[model samples]
Target: MKKKIWVNIAFQVGALVLALLSTTLLLLAAGAPPFQAYAAILKGAFGSAGSLETLLITWSPLLLTTAGVLITFSAGLWNIGVEGQMAMGAIFTTWMLRLLQETSLPPALTIVLGILAGIVGGALWAGLAGALKTFGGVNEIFGGLGLNFVSTALTIYLVFGPWKRPGVGSMSGTEPFDRSLWLPTLPDTELSLWSLTLSLLALVIIIVLLRGTHFGLRLKAVGKNPKSAFLMGVPTWQYSMLAFLLCGALVGLAGAIQVTGVYHRLLPNISSGYGFLGLLVSMLVNYQAVWVAPVAFFFAAVNVGSIQLQLMYKLDSSFSGVMQSLLVLLVLLGEGARQRFLRKH
Candidate 1:
């Protein structure tokens, strides 16, 4: 058992080293000084108070998204529709705020209702995908992809049509809400303690629920073999739907944070690709809940720091994406190689 553990660690470390080596070569090929670029990324992420603040701001939504995906993953679902779910969440939040902002309701109540609406919106969207998979015999991946496009279209229509700004429609999104409706934040920064606290709380809850609960065990069983789990009396379809709904709820909360805590209004790309990025984070962590926070934070830091790559080295920020992809790919490959090696020995 100890030997097996050591082998696992060795493989993981080898994967990390290969990922870094590949990234370094790519930087050299692009004529960027690899060491300087690395230093700049580190500095941009944590060099000062403001950079740290921005990193934390980026980390919050990522935490939520990653947490949401972890649930779906545990239930053996891809849930590619998470991006759409997030957009629908923002749309619903915006809709609810607009509905109540003119009422005599207190601003605090309005914000809470908006966030709740966002959660419902995300669940409704995920329910649609689950319905398609369960009853329509469509695969979740294709159903989710279709729903994602529809969600994008919906956002565009609202932004450019009904929710258009005062004079004309634009991609700038609808008019901003009053500051009273915005989530409370640290004095001068965009970082909201409420969002941070909620995200961390969500992460903690998910970790506990997945690691300690009978429900999590059954869910994983269903994921591993639906037929066997059903034979064992697990309500398979219900569990699948529940997973989708729960994932959607967390994702929707992320969208709510984006509106009330960050952007202060809806945007066409309000999901900011975090849904998809969360998928990468999940994959990198091998669907382990405990690793989600640190991996998501690292990804967030890379995203926040990549801005300096463009400014200081004239490199496209897509370098960060490349590095992320390589790391995930190499790690997966390394895991595969390790399994083959163990089998051979």
Candidate 2:
């Protein structure tokens, strides 16, 4: 246990170093001082209320998506379907909003319905992978991936078909939702405390579920050794499906929050790679649910910082992606080395 903890910590440090090195490379490549670029990113992401608001906006989706990934990961399942889940969630919420526009339901109730639609939408899409894993003998990774393409195509078709607004593929999406259904934002910041609160709630629930329940124990058992777990009478497939369902619901909530809080309409790139970033965050945090929060905030800062880096240093934003990839690779490698060292000792 001590060696495992040390290895995890070492991996995290390696990731941070890798990230810094990449940023420095980008700065040098652009013929700018790396320190100056770093300063700019920091300033741009948190210099004022507006910058902080942008950071919060960026933080929301990553936080929620990471939390979602944690569910399946805890159960030793790989769920790469969060991007598709998010898209479907937004699409479902938007469709429901349009369908219920003429109803006399209270605005609050309408908003609730939209959120529910998102949750249901994400679950169905993710549940298919779980089902395929259980019965069709398909791998969740490939299955979720294929479904992602389908989900994207479906969204495009919907916007161009019956759901199309006056201008198809325009930013406003199928139609502008009524103001009543929109999530209220804080006056002091563009950030919606309500949505942020939802993320916090998810984090708490996941921690409680994963570390404090029979379901969580079963999931850990499955993750550690499915055959042994099965022999011990654990229903591995059922647990896997449950994990997927929980993941979908969490990711769906993230999508709904984004639609209701930030964009107010579906953008084709609405997910904006936040799902993937969340994955990186989860890995860097060593799959510790509590650690995800701080790691997510750090990632959010860097992401927002990259926007500033591009604007101020005239550097490409791809620098952030490069840094993130390097971090993930180095961290993984470090973990491997640390484990090897432990074995030798």
Question: Per-prediction TM-score, please?
Answer: 0.98, 0.94
Clash pairs for candidate 1: none
Candidate 2 lDDT by residue in tens digits, 1-345: 887787777766876787688768867977989888888878987898788888888887888899999988888888887789888888888778777878998888888898889889888888998898889989989998988898888877887677777755564466667777788878766688888888888888998988899988999899889999999999888888888998898888888887787877776666678777888888877799988888798788888888887787778887777777777778877777777876796
Question: How do the residues 1-345 of candidate 1 rate in per-residue lDDT, one tens digit apiece?
Answer: 998999899999999999999999999999999999999999999988999999999999899989998998998999999999999999999999999999999999999999999999998998899989999998989999999999999999999999889999899998999999999988988789999999999999999889999999999988889999999999999999999999999999999999999998989999989999999999999999999989999998998888899999999999889988899999999999988878895
The lDDT for every candidate, in the order shown, is 0.93, 0.83
Backbone clashes in candidate 1 total 0
- Candidate 2 regions with alpha-carbon error over 4 angstroms: 1-15
Q: After superposition, how far is residue 217 of candidate 1 from its true place, in Å?
A: 0.9
Model 2 RMSD vs true structure: 2.0
Query: Which residue pairs in candidate 2 collide?
Result: none
- Give the lowest summed-lDDT range of ten residues in model 1: 336-345
